[model samples]
Target: MGGMIIVEEGALRIVGGLVDGRPVAIVQEADDVLFRVSGNSIEDAVAVARARLGAGGGVPSQRAPVDVPVDAAAPTPSVPPRDLRALLRAAVAAFDPLRSEGVTEGPGKDRYRKIYVAGWPALVHYEFLPSHARRHMGVELHVETEKAAAVTGILPALCAVVRDAMPGQAVVHDPNWVGGCGRLQVVFPDTATADTLARAMQQLIVLTRPRVEAALH
Candidate 1:
């Protein structure tokens, strides 16, 4: 017969049958020998165990019961990890608008909003300082575009929009163009500021960004 154990949400348990005259539970799922375990009640458990006994399941008997703690009390995270590597990778992957041209790179920690205009530098880094504990702060936008209009026109337009939406500071095109993997990042003073700035940018960029030409029929 199969064994029964009470478990919570994260409880790991014995999920195998007797093998080699000893109880054998797996640490994780086993490929070929998985179907052999189908026990619930005294009757069903034994039946499932026996069905796979002679088929291919070896006679090994070393089942280990795992105790996975219940996660009902643990709070789910609202924010992603601050690790720059993972953050940059995620940003690149999710840069849906840039599906075709130009690659996405780094959460390069910058003291101020760093811009890349012409060619990439050997090293480019930036930082994001969140304003969670602080009452007020500002967000600086960093960006790049194949069109010169983005540097002169688009980014300037974005600054005006942000000012209108929120009390924003000065917006200037960085004369020092430090390039890299071809993506731009705007660092906000805090999480809240970042979110708001991104939202505003998205609204404006959607309408203004050069539309992708439709495929020929």
Candidate 2:
């Protein structure tokens, strides 16, 4: 089976402070492996990791190539098939940077990943909005704390921060969100690739983690 490989900066053991290196994670049927790799960029790190695994920097196919005669009469489709699950997996792989910052990814439903933000595990919701004229696919990052005090104190501030940063998108606070705890949510159109989703999550982390830290102290 083709393994799930992840390349991220820094080690998992070291936290709270900054780590100054890159790490490659390879999870397969044989074994789960993680090791440091020397590189300036993720691409470089991936290459090194691929070498270690005896991979040629491409996804290994399960089946071997078979010779077949081409049918020239067959009509070629205009667009290729899109695999949402594969895209989600790619998105998770792109979120390697978040892992270093203690933003662990848990299981998610259908099209999104469950991302931990500011110590609160929230779902990265993928909604199908038929009402919208354009960009029907909506991606929302909803963060909430179970602590009652934080709902009144932190969520509003966090909502405001997201609203101010992304004025074009919808940002709201739902008091009934996630059972009873208040949730701060920021929504945007899902028009980009997996890398873009990872970047958006990282950007949100950068914007709100400081306030979260201050509230904790």
lDDT (tens digit, per residue) of candidate 1 on 145-212: 33333243344444445434432221222323434112222323222223344343353233323321
What are the per-residue Cα lDDT tens digits for candidate 2 across 1-217? 1111232222211001001223332222211124445434434544555566555456563433221112101111222334555655666688665554566666565545666644542432212111122221233344344453443466666766875776334444555656655555443333346675566567666777676656545
> Quick one: RMSD of model 2?
18.2
Off by over 4 Å in 2: 1-84, 98-100, 109-111, 117-145
Query: What is the number of residue pairs that collide in model 2?
Result: 0
In candidate 2, the residue pairs with backbone N, CA or C atoms under 3 Å apart (3 or more residues apart, or in different chains) clash, namely none
Quick one: best lDDT, which candidate? 2
Give the 10-residue window scoring lowest on summed lDDT in candidate 2: 12-21
- Residue 117, candidate 1: Cα error in Å is 16
What lDDT score goes with residue 209 in model 1? Answer: 34
